[model samples]
Target: MPRAGRPASPLITRRAAADAALSLIDSGGLDGLSLQAVARVLGVSAPSLYHHFRDKEELLTQVARCFLEEIGHQQERWSDDWETRTIELSLATRRVALRHPNAAPLALRFFPRKLMLPAYERSLVDCPYPPQFHAVILEAVEKFTYGSALFAAAAEAHHTPAMPPVDEAHFPYLASAIAAAPASDEDLHVEALRALLDGFRVRYGPRQR
Candidate 1:
């Protein structure tokens, strides 16, 4: 017997580490997430995770990258019209945020630019704004999408209503507006996207053919 070959160390791939971190986030939220926690999930020592992720921040960045990748997949089926695509992508982002409320904030802190550049380039192909203004338009859309998703996810996770109850006599107009608002978060997101796009169109006009 060849000296009972040293027991092989447990394998831990980058994808596996990221998956474990994401699961930890999903089950317990970010406060509970740690390299040690992820190692525990993978049944490996904390040092084992270091082979793939340098630190918890790196691991969390990978988690955010993976989350954005899900939305990227949805982009393949988006409408050809830029405005429509904007709404579709925004809603898709919102859906992912809602699904991973605990991990959603990572998007703000660590955007995976390399993973998203291709999709961003593609959006410009049919965009109605000039190349010079593409950044402005896209940035506005992206900011709104991220901000809206963050707010919506937090509210949903805490079981908070979009509009808390208000006294009708004290604020009749506001109360009436809230009463007439769309009943679902997605509906609200779409309405806001449309309004933002409409403003962009007005300011930029269509790109010169």
Candidate 2:
């Protein structure tokens, strides 16, 4: 049975439900998540969850926005070189994804939707490049970030196994790199992210090589 007039505190109702949903993702991978599960955890009717978020997609978007807002908060906290700030943003978000592996796939798309646009918009607004040329810079940066985030999230969700041991003689370079660098899945992912940032610097940073 259920007992409810509107919650005594509407904001608490919404935040409690959202946090519960995120907690469920933390406890059980995304496959284990459902709006009903969130409502049950929060001791509310599922309709109440709907009131806060139109659908699961909106819920996911809100979660992703929460993640972006966290990044913005961190950026505000530190004044640092832009490259370091960018790395901190990427690595911190990766840690957040690892913490809530279930919700990551849904959350990853937020980069293109909300994160990158304002960044590119600000650059276009401030930089010397013409709009057409700035679009090139935007395109290059997005291709890397979008691809890397999705790939890392999927890998973590799937618990993708490390590259299997292999005959080094057959694939010399890859084998040597794997053995010498010895990437845990997370390490490979972070390094790959750094590589993308490096590419962007060459293409878009001052004194491009």
Candidate 3:
């Protein structure tokens, strides 16, 4: 939608401010953004923002919560392989973060709000894994998802390339694995996760002996 008029009222005023803040962060990194910046973009007094938010942290919390809620909402009707739930959710999260790459880091973790946490809990409850295993599995998946995206995005956008390495002797399997799946971040994340679960099954899943 085009931005061409004043916000209709207090309700939209707050949402307008949030949308402006998102744009500011996307244009300039989060470090370059500020509440005053958002307020200016919204054509409102900086202090007026306080009418809707207690402080920058409060505003950021709202922004982060909104992103998480969007991610949760998008996955509300998923019907894919149950084992792939975490992977698909991680991908959905990446898609959300991609929309606000500058704020991607902030969207890296689940919002801690009661309303948001319950949604995550509900997803876990529906997963095939038991609670104890689900927690461990999801935690590991989220870490890889966020961490890979961070490094990958930075490397692609700003970092210089490093020389490729060559290894042979005792690292044959490691080399084969890398060759089998290329070094692209998402591919690496998926391959690593698959290897992890495969290893888990072999080592711990109802030992065949």
What TM-score goes with each of the models?
Answer: 0.88, 0.71, 0.73
Residue-level lDDT for 99 in candidate 1: 90
**CA lDDT of every candidate:** 0.86, 0.63, 0.66
Best by lDDT: 1
Error of 3 at 6 (Å): 12
User: Which residue pairs clash within candidate 2?
Assistant: 30-102
Listing every candidate in turn, what is its Cα RMSD in Å to the true structure after a full C-alpha superposition? 3.2, 4.7, 5.2
Cα miss at 11, model 3 (Å)?
Answer: 6.1
Arrange candidates by TM-score, descending: 1, 3, 2
Q: Please provide, for model 2 over 30-124, each residue's C-alpha lDDT reduced to its tens digit, 9 standing for 90 to 100.
A: 67878899888877677768767888877666666665555455544533455555556666666665655666666655433646577556545
In terms of lDDT, model 1 sits at 0.86
- In candidate 2, how many Å is residue 185 off? 5.5
lDDT: worst 10-residue window of model 2: 71-80
* Native-to-model Cα distance after best TM-score fit, residue 60 in candidate 1, in Å: 0.7
- Tens digits of per-residue lDDT, candidate 1, 59-126, equal 98899888998887865566878888888889999999999888888988898888888888888888
